[model samples]
Target: MAGTGRAGVWAVGSAAVAVGLIVALAVRERTAAPTDARPLVVYAAASLRPAFTRIATEYEAETGQRVELRFGASEEMLTRVRLPSAVDPGDLFAPADESYVTSADKLGLVAESRPVARMRAVLLLAPGRMPPTAWGDLASRDMRVSLANEAAAIGRLTRQRLIATGLWRELEPRVRGAATVTDSANAAKLGAVDAAIVWDAVARQYPDQRTAELPELTGIEAEVRVAVLRQSARPADAERFLRFVLDPEHGLRHFRDLGFRVVE
Candidate 1:
């Protein structure tokens, strides 16, 4: 009887030890760092590269998630997102203007959009050139003016402003078009053109160049917008990233630091 009781106690002790070990292992596994962190893909306008890159870095550090960024002109990015392809589409699309987001939403490409920042078209002047005070000055025959190609958001805004002010027909002949806003700004910086119509942020990039506010461009600010794509495999992650970007302390601060105007 005594031997049997001792054997039963040993058995019980062994079983308890085994159960404790199993529970400990389970807890450790639960607390262990995740091995498979899915990456979030983002398609953004080229003009947003600097600020977005910084925000991506900060997000990755804080969330332990990865970010893949694709940068191009806003219209070009939109076209890429709309392309029918076998490969997976990006998780998010951030365009330089709100119209692109609205078009994407209409096409069922975007699930939702939020305005993140704002910018305005301005005249960037070559070194030693006097700033133009009015829209009519851009139509001067002697002035060699650089303008963004129609594909860029800045280009569309510039054309709209010119048309609204009745200067498009008169200034169209003097305009030299470039592929991107950066190129247009560079044309002025390199003295290839007397002036360029570019975003205020782009003009800020070349401190040596001068920026002039065209009275006609008033109230024509570009509203930068970010959207979660309908085809995104990870919509939650995309929304999280969008929230991070719109966060006043995190992403908007980066935008402001990079000379971008954050939308209030």
Candidate 2:
């Protein structure tokens, strides 16, 4: 009887030990699983590359997350994001301007949107060359003025707004002709055309490019929009990244240095 009782006691002890081992293993696995969030995909505007790159590097250092960038024109980026199978889409979309955001919002593709920075078109002229000091001067045959198309919303708006204000029309005959329109004003500047309309951000890039505010010019305050795409597998990470951009001091200064006017 005593031997049987001892055997029963051993059996119970063995079962308890087995159960404890099982719990221990589960706890180990739960604790050991990777919790570090890093490496997220980002699609941004080509024009925004300089300022955004600085913000990206800072983000990586503060957090372990890596930014895999896809940079291009805002229109191009918007089209890419619209594709049906863009499942597992980019973690973030930082378009050069907000028109893309309005379009993306209509498609229900953007998960989160925020206006982080603003900018407007400026008249760019070659360094050391005579620039039209006023809008009326553009009508002169000597002033070869260039401007970007409607696809660049601000570019298109700048023309109309300035004209509405009685500024652009003064130069419309000379500046609006086919010879004056270019895919991008930056291209015109690179081609060394006398003057072209371009974003303040872009204008700031070329040290040789001088910027002047054309009085009565249509000044559309384009906001640089940052959003999270719906296909993103990492929403939390995307939110974190968005916060990084909107952070008041550090990243904001980076944008300002690039000539982006941040909204209050």
lDDT of each: 0.84, 0.74
The C-alpha RMSD in Å for every predicted model, in order, reads 14.6, 15.3
Q: Residue-wise lDDT of candidate 2 within 1-264, one digit each (tens)? A: 366698888888999999999999989976754345436778898778887889989998988677777898788888888863444467888887788888998999899899887777777775555666776666654667676666676666776787677666566655633221234455555655677777676677777766788755545667788999887888899898888888877678788777678864
The digit string of per-residue lDDT tens for model 1 on 1-264 reads: 366798888888999999999999988976653437647889988878998899999999999898988898777888988983546578999987787898889899988888877788888999999997676666553788898877677788778877987878888888999988889888898899999888787788888878898777676677888899988888988999999999999999998898888875
> Which candidate should be chosen as best, given lDDT against the real structure?
1
> Candidate 1: misplaced stretches above 4 Å?
1-35, 84-87, 139-141
TM-score of 1: 0.80
Off by over 4 Å in 2: 1-38, 84-87, 166-170, 176-183
- What RMSD value applies to candidate 1? 14.6
Residue 95 shift from truth in candidate 2, angstroms: 1.2
